[model samples]
Target: MATPADLPDSVYLEIFSYLSVRDRIRSSRVCRRWKRLVDDRRLWRHVDLTLYTMRPKVLWHLLRRYMASRLHSLRMGGYLLSGSQAPQLSPALLRALGQKCPNLTRLCLHVANLTMVPITSLPCTLRTLELHSCEISMAWLLREQDPTVLPQLECIVLDRVPAFRDEHLQGLTRFQALRSLVLGGTYRVTETGLESSLQELNYLQRLEVLGCTLSADSTLRSVSRHLRGVRKIRLTVGGLSAPGLAALERMPVLESLCLQGPLVTPEMPSPEEIVSSCLTMPKLRVLEVQGLGWEGQEAERVLCNGLPHCSVIVRPCPKVSMDWWM
Candidate 1:
């Protein structure tokens, strides 16, 4: 009978592609041939270390052993602990990553400590950078010597970062190429900072401000004035004022709008006002309203009746899972 070891190199590689990073390492121990095949650059094109909580030294060892210039994307999870126990990325490790993964375009870090890491040390080829529930200092965001680091970066997602504040937002305005920005669960960002930063990002096309406590109706007005080209927006903010709704109506290219969280208050725009506003938006296609409970049914009927060409969704707020923030 034939054995598994007899499989062709291509066949083995194909099979290995279906395995997770951990499984690939385990399979490498089976034999020297398997180990050699596991080191193929094609297999490490998109590395996902999200399930691992290894220290920086361990991560450096893993990357040096497996990562190559062909790497395109990397998703990593870090351990968040106090003092020496924290799994922070060091300058040396970041420099190694930039050198080893020159082609890396997307990098996502979750629950990481980046207090000591300068953003400039990141791979310059990166186009998208996401930091979730990470510890980032103000200096880290503001630090830039060349102003050319990560020049290709176009999308940035900062979610639940405790240190994110107005100064950080101002610092980000330097990235004029940014197109998609997601700020979720960031309460320190105020309307002034938002307006100031947004006006500089004329290229931004998608924006999501979710679970922001200070984001009120006036914030929407600022977005309307600064981001006239924005096509998709999802806001979880406080009660909507009439001027906010009116400002949104002027957006010539907006296609999708999602209003939820504090937007569901009894003071929300009436069905007639929402329908009238929707009428002015020539490109409006989807309008979603959440957390309205019984009050939403009437708005649903009115929206569906008023705008036959649009998709309208009205429902109570869905329970968010703990992992949603991460």
Candidate 2:
């Protein structure tokens, strides 16, 4: 019946900015100035309720009272303070919305049932933090978030997180405008605490780890000597060992390298013995090998020997077969 105060205020704040706090309390009965413009704090910037509703803390006290001055960005997994049954966040409502959301930046917490993250109760004005399946301590998030003098942090996506420790390793060497870091489902990890957290990410270039567990091989060759401005390195060394493939020959501008693993035996090495030990980097172009156990003449002699330059791609894993890459 198009009621809700004849739908204005920019179409009821763009339809109560995508409802779902049980339909913003059943659209506040469409009256009394649309329930004061649905408890206007400019109809809350962006607060998605994570669905499994029943009035999660009265929608977290409607974001800790009267839309805590039009909060910035807050996307949770489900409710109380982050789903999966929602609970931990009541240290006085995370210290009164971490002392009233000073334009809180972006917090997309998924949920893993806590390990740490009181975030000293927030207000560092975060830039981007996306942690899915979080059971974080990340050394109490580098001693309660500093982000290099809080200069609008760059990016951090810890997906599938198992555990992140190594007490700040020099505060990730002072972010200094970090680029991109993604650790996807890293399994059973230890590699000397990811080689001193990879030389403090000295302005990290771009790196991704999927299912890793690296540790020895001279601590992954001293964690590949800080990957000299790494250009792109994705890995899946499934159970990782053998000096973690000799620590990718210490990354000298590693152009590209992707490896997905499980085994083809001899403790898995033959993608032409890992491109003849990364042919001394010199800016490698590309080399992708995914569960190589179908051999194809040793994956075509590890993609035509010496890599000829680089650009090599192999995807044959299909749950391992073909005589297990003879």
Candidate 3:
């Protein structure tokens, strides 16, 4: 017999927390009390505006009002399609955000333009930065700036960033706290670049490289010798090579490995060869092979035979989904 308005402020805020940003905006119109409860900063701690299309001013206003000193994680931006100028985070807005949200630790930007913002202007508290399909000069990040600007930064994910080249790796060495790195769909990085840069990452524990050439014997050998502390690795192997497999055996602390892309090629090692090589990896526990066709089962069986203590998982790659924006 009690109306929804009869719920306490705490209950109303909890309910608002469960609603999406759009739905929460609608609920705010219910009443003054509801509006105030919906505006609570706790609900805006993890803001995700990736699906929304709004002007820069609107986003800035929202951040100033709701996210100041409250936001911890933020994901923004959308696909930059042809003939459409979408709203983007500008340099001034980024500087304001850094000034307002000093506690923000994680940030992900997709298809956003950060070419104008200086890396030193970013929040110093950030620990993780993911930039997917974005336009930003790597030189800004690599330039000689105060190391204290991003002292806590540890994890960096650069996916499909055309501007990210092998030279950028030299800049990353400046981040002494870096621990995890993912370089996917970066065509410019060759085996030589990876070998040269990886030696400086003494503290790196997790590494992933996809769609880049890594078939050379010397490349894998260098990886084995320098990255002795790596615990997890993911690679896109179009054709499995003996030297690549040998590198896996050298990582004494390696626990999880994901090998994706084509498993069988004319020049690749045989299933038996792969299985035999894996036996040298004593501490490996999880092995995942993806993007295989009908031959996945056979590969899984052979891998399991050699690494009896490790769990092997094989699955076909999923179809790519397309998204269209109006």
Local distance difference test scores for all models: 0.80, 0.61, 0.74
TM-score of every candidate relative to the true structure:
0.84, 0.29, 0.87
Candidate 3's C-alpha runs over 4 A off are 1-18, 78-87, 216-219, 294-296, 318-326
Clashes of 3: 0
lDDT of 2 by residue, 54-167 (tens): 344665667666557578877666232444555554445545554677786766666534454455554456676666766756555574465444456566666665665455
Query: Model 2, residue 117: what's the lDDT?
Result: 44
Backbone clash count, each prediction separately: 0, 3, 0
Off by over 4 Å in 1: 1-18, 31-42, 143-145, 294-301, 313-326
Q: Put down candidate 1 lDDT per residue, 194-294, tens digits, no spaces.
A: 88888787678888887777645867788888999999887774757656777888688999887776455656777788888888988999988777563
Candidate 1: C-alpha lDDT: 0.80
On residues 159-267, what C-alpha lDDT tens digit does candidate 3 reach at each position? 8888887787767888999998888777777777787788897679888776665553444566687888888877776646776677667478888877766635665
**Candidate 2 structure, TM-score to reference:** 0.29
Deviation in Å, model 3, residue 43 alpha carbon: 2.1
Provide the RMSD of all predictions against the true structure, rounded to 1 decimal.
Answer: 3.5, 16.9, 3.9
lDDT of 2: 0.61
